[model samples]
Target: MSLRDTFRRDQVFAPLRPGTRPVRPGQLDTGGKHILYMEDITVSFDGFKALNDLTLYIKPGELRCIIGPNGAGKSTLMDVITGKTRPDTGSCFFGQTMDLTRMTETEIATAGIGRKFQKPTVFPEHTALENLELAMAGPKGTWQALLQPVTGQQYDWMAQTLETVGLLAQKDQLAGALSHGQKQWLEIAMVLMQKPRLLLVDEPIAGMTRQEVERTAELLQSLAGEHSVMVVEHDMEFIRSIANTVTVLHQGSVLAEGKMQDVQNDPKVIEVYLGETG
Candidate 1:
């Protein structure tokens, strides 16, 4: 089946103003247009099709959620987008320029794509603010990271980020001491400091308390119009809270894509994934 048989590109990208600046070349030239592009992407592991002729698109400043069961190619799709795994066929692009299929993982990150995994990772011994400092020190020489004091401007920048993630009150607290939700926010704050154009987040509220899940939704909502965020999650309730659009995957292909309620009601989705869940 053709990709458009399920969803439309025009619908995927709703317009919003961009929020950050590009720090490096090959950055997305969204111009309030498409931030991500993919078509006919396929990946195989020993004759097992992890992803099969996948085609997807995301718009600038959009918050999109992907819901699918295991083996639906969700993780592999992220791996392909991040340059961790290359597609055996098809193509991927970021913005109007920069072919994503050709760039290295490091180049993908340098070009303003940020990824947050399922588990929150923070510097346990470091304070919330210090943890951000270390995050900002990405790939720098060890000595340089250690010798450099956070400048007043850098601290100011981080302070703003702290407030953004609802960590302003916990800035001086040890990261390890923070609650699970707070740790997730701290990790999110760390990524924002890099001014990424696109953020790929996995199951952000998986282990969060109800309150934290609510707050995380607010945080993600606040990030739109500056950063395009794509969330991969299985929590339907959480997706309902934050998803502007929901895409459902089955057998490495999109089964449905649209509003949360609409996708949830799709018979195909219900049979394959949601039926067993609820």
Candidate 2:
């Protein structure tokens, strides 16, 4: 096995060591064009190919959804894009400049990519406002991060973010006190405050109420012009509501890509998701 393959196996099977020292948010500007482009990304785990020559792209201000059956390598693909996992051989680029395959996760995030896992990971003990405050904190372990007070601009950004997420009135409320939907919104808001250029959201409406799902759809739609969003979701209804374009993954490669309606009707996508779920 090659060294890169060994590293991939370690990352998949070994205990993940915690990351150290936070990095700056990457520039949120997508240069008003193609924000992310990937070509021939491949990752193998213990001799199993998780990603197979996958090529994907996102234009600025686009909201794209990815859906796939289990073991389709959906999560692994996200890991590669976000720099959490390195591809055995491929090229990943952000904007027109930085090469993502060469950057660390911290550097990639600093360059303005933000990811949200399925669960809301807010600072439960902190009030809504305080959580945003901490999200805006500079690189951790730095002198300025410890010595610096929240700047007026940061405060302004926090307040605007709270308002944007419809939590301005609940700024002082404990995060744990919020409902499931509210907590989800708060987490998204936290990332928004960083003003990332690309946001990757995973399973956002997994447990949300119908009303909450509707609102969340609207929220993501509103962010379209200012941020490029890539959503991974299992909820077909949610995808139908929000996706402008949809990409289906199966066995670690693009099974289909097009409008949601077109992809939904695809024989390959239907055969995979329908055969299993049916």
Candidate 3:
């Protein structure tokens, strides 16, 4: 069957996993409104400032797109939010209660922050279903996962997640057998398996075909109402499709923030992000 046919047929009956629970649609900002906040976040690498007093705030269930030129500290911002890199001085909050700055990466993830890296990281040897199973959230004790198989609710969650990411039919296929775009979606599905409150996605359409990119845009858009997504991406077209609010960065600070059209029309934003010629 053609890829299109496969997608249509496979999309149906995508929720057949046994012993899995159906993840309830919950508020992305479970901690009472404020999902993420960064104030005066600054980070430097040997005197070269990567993030200079950067501040960002994301509202609950908002799909925010961040665009910037090279060396604008986009990646560093994500790192700070995820607790992978602590800033020299700043405050990061996961909600009204949890202070992200004091937490470790693992702690932050457990606190409802899920990050999808630029590269897909699914285990090549594992089937897509197994890869997602390994990512199920909760106690990491081997006994909890192995001796006690995932409950039906968990399986339902996984199945729904697979369908959401457009990979339900490929669940039995080896991760190694998927195409580049499919692998990217698989990686995203793995993250969804944990049912995070906030999701941070990076360059989701980096190397996808035109059709794949469009479909991916639709998927992300569908997820916005249920998850607060902070996407750092370079593809302006893809950003336009998914962004409800656009932020432009230059020299580690916000240069422009508004609708895509407004930001694009800003002369300074044009000079920094879009060339004057374009």
Error of 2 at 173 (Å): 0.3
Question: What are the per-residue Cα lDDT tens digits for candidate 1 across 32-59?
Answer: 4578877788999999998998888898
Best by lDDT: 1
Global fold similarity of model 3 (TM-score): 0.85
Model 1, residue 187: distance off in Å is 0.7
TM-score preference between candidates 1 and 3, better one: 1
Across residues 1-278, which tens digit of lDDT does each residue of candidate 2 receive?
Answer: 74333323223333321121133334333442367877778899999999998878788889999999988888998899889999998777776556788899888887888888899999888889888877773565434443568778888889999888789999999999999999999999988876788999989998899999999999999888789899998888888999889999999998988998898888888999845654
Q: Which candidate number maximizes TM-score?
A: 1
Candidate 1, residue 234: the lDDT equals: 82
- The clash number for model 3 is 13
Candidate 2 has a TM-score of 0.85
Query: TM-scores of all models?
Result: 0.89, 0.85, 0.85
lDDT of each: 0.84, 0.81, 0.79
Candidate 1, superposed: residue stretches over 4 Å from native? 1-27
